[model samples]
Target: TLPVLAEPRAAQDLGDWLRELQAFNLSAREHAHTPLSDIQRWGGQAGQRLFDSILVFENFPLEDALASAGRSGLRFETQGSTGLTEYEMDVEVSLRQTLRLSFTYMRRAFDAEQVAAICAQMMALLGAMGTSPAQTVGSLSLLGPDEQAALLALGQG
Candidate 1:
């Protein structure tokens, strides 16, 4: 495990947090080069006690290029070494139930309703930041006025 920074005040600023996160990432990558045999041995010995959940983030730079180039001629091969199915194959082989959330920053059209909802939430979050800039991000309210009232009522009940 990487060492946690003890500076909460420093982490309150987004820029500082980002810098610390980058430092942690560098430390993690430096420590990540363990032998395959050691990993296999650990997994083999770790019998039935499997982790129930995991979060995965993968970077596919070519995906944007492929999307821009148009995917009509693009054949999605399921068995290739570097194909999109690699992650699927891992999931199948591991027999793990995974829920993946993919967020991309490309100029692709999304469902209008979903996109509007996302934008509204972002606006709400920005408004929250404006009202309470000094508060920690975790303490900010992301809910709309109605939802906040409902939640307050529920809490009172």
Candidate 2:
């Protein structure tokens, strides 16, 4: 897993944030063969956890791989969950013909409603970033028009 510390500043635009990520990925590729243990040792935090959340991108064609595994007359299916998570939250992105995203979170830390809202906000932010890459990150709206109007009404009350 490639470790990426992506904290977009309020003044930074989406394009700037993306560029930073691209640069970091390129640099990380240079040391892609390095073991995670070695990296942790170098950072002087061998036993420490660096992050609580992880993002996994599945770019390979799983079906094709399974078909090529020489298992004739046998079918393979993807498991949805193993009833376990290594991190507080896990975001999985499957880069198929249609992009798919799945989020798994610890029940103790977040409720389903909260996760749903987070998903909505994330989609909104992604849409905004795609449409207006030059817009400042802080200027992006996480709330929909109805939600914004409701918040304004509550504030007035």
Candidate 1, position 142, lDDT = 64
Q: Write down the lDDT of every candidate, Cα atoms only.
A: 0.49, 0.79
Write the residue-wise lDDT of candidate 2 on 1-157 in tens digits.
6566678898987788889988988898888888767777888979887777877777796766898774776777778784335888888878777878789999887899998998888777677777878888888899866677989999999
Task: For candidate 2, give the lDDT of residue 143.
Answer: 81
Using TM-score, give the best candidate's number.
2
Each candidate: RMSD: 11.0, 3.0
Strongest candidate by lDDT: 2
Clashes of each: 0, 0
Q: Which residue runs of candidate 2 sit more than 4 Å off their true CA positions?
A: 35-37, 64-75, 83-85
Quote model 1's TM-score: 0.39
User: 47-71 in candidate 1: lDDT tens per residue?
Assistant: 3423322223444444455675666
